[model samples]
Target: MNTIDEFNIDVRALNVLLAVLDTGSVSAAAVRLGVSQSAVSHTLDRLRQSLGDPLFVKSGRGITPTRYTLQAGPHVRQLVGELRSLSVGPPFSPDEAELTFTVAANDYQRDLLLPPLMASLRETAPGIRLQVMPSGIPNPEMLRKDVCDLVISPHPPAVGDVMQRRLLDDHMTVFYDADQREAPESLADYLQSRHIGILFATGERMALEASLSTQGLSRDVAVTVSNFSGLPAFLKSTDLLATAPYRMKDHLLKGFQRAPLPFELKPFTLLMLWHQRNHEDPAHRWLRQQLIDVAQGLES
Candidate 1:
């Protein structure tokens, strides 16, 4: 007979077990974790020996969590959360601390906000590295899933175990090429001219379009692009217009010119979001404050 006191249990094993439980299959869990099924099976084997119970059982085409797993699942998830929180120590010195953070933002936010923020971080927190992922729309679960440390967007998650701060708000303005087409001086001219629509990956219309629809007004959208980065290619030589936030005026509209929207539209607010798990972490709090400071400086 083999004893259960041979191996040490770690958080990675716990996470592997929870992934298996949540996915209901070792292969599926492996796919989610970017690991091999054999590795997941090995982790499960070790966990079974240590816990003195088979946490899962094969059932026909798939597997099901056993009674032990049913009871321990919630506690294991909580344990993983607590373990993650331990990374941010109480004494945080930006000059001496080394850390890596991931952020998600679309092209507009990425271009408008990150350059200045990076300059500040390089000057103050030289040891920190920032990775930015493209954000299609606001999804707070990225923080809960530990995929990113922060998310910047106009549409923040409305309800969740997350904290959000209003960074700044900007009104909508139409950007057009002055050399190709004159600025629209009236509502009819704005609506009749060809426009470039910025649609997200999910096929969701922008808030600007929604505002126009509410007023029974619509633009003649000739082309649709996924982000603001694609607009310059189409707008520079053609008679196309792009309605975007005014904050992008300095960075996104260098050769282009902006004009007031012919119709009234509500200003959109950009928000910074982080998980509640990081709410009290000193390092995370410091980074969040730095972002807020950067945004305030731009606003002023």
Candidate 2:
């Protein structure tokens, strides 16, 4: 077996390994690394030869990590994270820095966060352009791969290695057309009304359903969509009501009327998450601070 120093593994190869481990397949790793599948395979071969072990092998359909990989994965991840931290230097100067940051958030967050955030950036960091990517929920592995610079979600994932900061507390509200006659005033009335729910491909829609069931009532789901932005449009044409965060109601559906949720639901925290690898990056720190400031201003 080669010593850690004698191994002389290329940083690029280590990066490839980390990507594959996080994504669970060579093809996926290739996409994340912005390289061809052949390149990822070649790097895997080199890593296997150097390590004298099959790091990953094809299982029934997908690749599974071998014993060696399972043991070495954490160390490799930590090493790569440390290296990335070392590569990032001082805080970026807003006026001089040329950067495009990608942020992952849902439509509700976009409504509440983007307008003010853009205004602040225009006044302070005019050179920085932000790209908002629609994200369903927090995924730590994706954050580590730098798929998004930050994730703004209602709840943080249970992963310990990721760093999270609470931006705001979100409470539920029911929205309906302002001119609607049969506005729901009680849980029973709400259950009788046609409801529209915004659900992603992978989301916790069942949780809301289950919560309603506990109250001995169920919503008649008239429509299911992926985002809250479209709900107001749907409500405008019909009496169908939708449930969403209170913070979004004012921004997305200005003319729509909202009422408190009939059944009690716990308030959820909106958190900003990033990989531990970026925890110390000066530019990342500045961005995180700006986000906090924006959220605080909105809440105030």
Candidate 3:
């Protein structure tokens, strides 16, 4: 037998050896590989020179692998298999994948967006799991710490390598129980009204409060809550007004009435955020696109 380092080796030559051994005929192996018989024979000659083994011998009208080739066949098959696996990344198939994703969202985004997202996932990626966590004023540290895969928020991180896209822009509106009180007809009426305000964990007051403070006017905040979902309960039985996004009419403000804010408030833009590391990942891209689609559907 020749020394292992004496002759150059190639994967195609190894494959030819496996095919010849399995079929016990060069012509049949060539058919399996879509090659001419002479090509198969030439590959076999190269493999024989490299390994210094008469890998096959004539037997009647067919062929038989030598004892040496038979003894090494399985190991050779494994080596070829491993080499193939190393040649490329496996393509992503959402229908066949088993994956879990996490999202950080405030109660507003969670209630407004995720239910439709989950419903869509159920149809498109049955094997995928979803986890939603509170995203109280998202920052880059949350992503750097691997706290969540994506964040849905109105606030965007100020740090670099944090990617974002605006999902929708929503203007503030006054939500109230129509049966309890009439909608505020003027800025003076809105300011005089008792309000239920949202206080984020970060100590950043809601945009309405900031806007009012900027104009040297403020509302009588009779109650403070953390999430939009709870505003309906407070406003449902009383004359208290909840200043919330117009989109809340479909979500948290159902059975309540909403009218445009009596004063001009700059619209809030809801954004989707993710770390740079996940930007090019196929599964992450797919989920992002799914969210974009859901947002578009909601707007339409």
Candidate 4:
């Protein structure tokens, strides 16, 4: 077995090769490495010359790994993983660790999760900073590429090389302004009323539709917005009602009112997703566990 030193392939070059294999394009890999596309292409050329095989060939839209490259890909990825793990120190002490973690979540989860999360961070992990970004359905591929440090969503993403843990289950609930109209007494009334649909760009709009279809009823979606925080303001003057997770109801509509869904909508299990790259990092593990605890303690 030839070691990296014997092959004259440094860790940086191996990393560039792994990035190309994972991203399937020199440009994308370059972006990930914060280098120009030409640099990635040159690295690939060097790797091919050293290995005596065309590692990747241009496909219809992107590059495809050759048989030899495919065989080596996993090994290279594993090497990078081992190196990262070895470099990481003991679990980070929240009070002393200066770190910033990026989390992607939908507006509903953001409403329910952020307040308590921030409060906990302020009290216990003040040195650690957080940036909450709006994420649609979680994308494991993006997570693996380090686009997001964590994803908090109803369903775990279906990307390979990622880990998921169920945080809590949140059921759907209906919300409307306090004085807009009387609370819907039944599913029939709920379906017939004008409704506001909150649509995340990547989420399935059919979940609510399917639930309504079961009762042979449907909603008149007067407006479709991108966030739950705006639904309360939208319902201020109209008879429009909004539906969201039960946990989000109180936080999103603090001054508004809510009622149970007229029809039985299955609860969605919220899961926290992270890349395998950070699986062994103590700080990462601590943050993940803290989120699970906060989510589990929510009243829903």
Task: Give one digit per residue, the lDDT tens place, for model 2 in 59-86.
Answer: 9999998989888988988787778877
Clashing pairs in 4: none
- Model 3 spans > 4 angstroms off: 1-88
Superposed Cα deviation of residue 54, candidate 4 (Å): 3.2
Count clashing residue pairs per candidate.
0, 0, 0, 0
TM-score of 1: 0.71
lDDT of the candidates, in the order given: 0.85, 0.82, 0.85, 0.79
Task: Answer with 2 or 3, whichever has the higher lDDT.
Answer: 3
- Badly placed stretches (over 4 Å) of model 4 are 1-6, 49-53, 89-91, 136-148, 154-165, 176-187, 199-218, 222-226, 233-240, 254-267, 273-279
lDDT of predicted model 1: 0.85
The full ranking of all candidates by lDDT, starting with the best, is: 1, 3, 2, 4
Q: Whole-model lDDT for model 4 versus the true structure? A: 0.79
RMSD of 2: 4.6
User: Per-prediction TM-score, please?
Assistant: 0.71, 0.71, 0.70, 0.74
Model 2 gets an lDDT of: 0.82
Which candidate tops TM-score? Answer: 4
Candidate 3 C-alpha lDDT tens digits along 1-300: 788779777888887888787667898778766799999999988888889889999889878889999898978877776776565467778898899999999888898999999999999999988999998878766775678999999887775447899898888888898888999999999899999998877787888887888899988999998778779778988999998888888877878888889878898889999975566677888999999999999889
- Provide the lowest-lDDT 10-residue window in model 3: 81-90
Compared with the true structure, the alpha-carbon lDDT of candidate 3 equals: 0.85
Q: Write the per-residue lDDT of candidate 4 for residues 1-300, one digit (tens) a residue.
A: 344454767778988987787777789788877899988888887777777789999889887999998898888878877878887977578888788999988777777777788899999989888898877766665686777899888776554457799887877778788776988988678878899986756656738887667767767899998677767778887788888766664566776678887666677887888987788788998999889878877844
